[model samples]
Target: MTPSAEILAFMGRLGHDFARPEFLVRALTHGSIASATRPDNQRLEFLGDRVLGLVMAEALFHADTQASEGQLAPRYNALVKGETCAALARQIGLGEVLKLGRSEMLSGGRRKEALLADGMEAVIAAVYLDAGFETARRVVLNLWRDRLDTIEDDPRDPKTALQEWAQANGMKPPAYEQTGRGGPDHAPVFHITVRLDNGETAAAQGSGTKRSIEQAAARTLLERLEGRE
Candidate 1:
């Protein structure tokens, strides 16, 4: 099949025209729609994940001259995590260019955070393959400019913080339970409740996935307990 105008438009938005157009096509192809001639983006995603990590690490390290390893680590994790990738994908309209199978399309695969995140990574790999690491690094730095600029210093994972708080207060570890799921299989919403042994609890719904929903619930509980909310 011919690549759609939308795909070209997305490439323009990404600020990189493919040297090999097929790389872009393959990057946009989801696993559910993969064929012998139309390979999926999983391999590209793998490479792109590394590329993204390296770029983020370098950027973070340089951005903060005095930040210890401990401070830089969590900031790196937060920037490279799936949720952040998905948000970046949405910023570039990556979901609009994705090629998905019929079932996935019907099930809202384009909106699924997992798919979007993977697609973003695949696109990064595609850019690297088309040009070089320098080009890919430039693209990533440009795309992630705002996030990198505004990233929290000494970021802490909410779940870890919550667990630490629980232990400090002599309460059992926080327990997370899935309370509900809705929407299609591919784009399901997850509702989760995080409860501490001491009776503090918070519930939250997220469109990302079970892990994101659970994280959100944990963060909400942490905020509530800490009186931040």
Candidate 2:
């Protein structure tokens, strides 16, 4: 079957041309709009998650041959995390091509981070199925080239890093508190504060989710603690 103009344009952005375009279509199909004939992308997302993990692990292993597993683990997580996938999806305009149900579309499903991340993973699975591991790996590496190059600079998750810092400094683990919340229910904002036993603290707000706000707060606190802010 001939691919639509939009799919073709998306392919250009994705840096891959699908031999079986149906896979691409299914990758973009959310469960909300799925039927017996038109399957959703959940299975593809699952497969792609593993594929992405393997690709990232291999890339990190080879990129820093001298680094220990402890050092590489955080870097691997930073590269293959759902947030990273969502950011990459946004770069390629993946949300614009997603096939969502009316309810999901009305609820701003296109902009949802989880949905976009899942779609990105499904797309990777599609690429893997359409071609092979080599082609999928090439596409993943190409899409993540910038991130991969910079992953060594600050690869640890903010919360994890903050906890480790506290432990190393003979302090208790950092405490995260939900200070407040605002905005409408559909688009609520979370306010989080991360405080250390040393009486240092940082606050941040996130429109994305509670966990994101916590991470933001942790990052701010970490930066302040390290005198990098």
Give all candidates' CA lDDT scores.
Answer: 0.90, 0.92
Kindly list the per-residue Cα lDDT of model 1 for residues 50-100, writing each as its tens digit. Answer: 999999999999999999998999899999999899999999999898999
TM-score of 1: 0.92
Which of the numbered candidates is closest to the native, going by highest TM-score? 1
Model 2: residues >4 Å from true position, as ranges?
Answer: 169-172, 197-200
Runs with alpha carbons beyond 4 Å of true place in candidate 1: 1-3, 183-187
Name the weakest run of 10 consecutive residues (lDDT summed) in model 2: 148-157
**How much is 68 displaced in model 2, in angstroms?**
1.5
Model 1 whole-model lDDT (C-alpha atoms)? 0.90
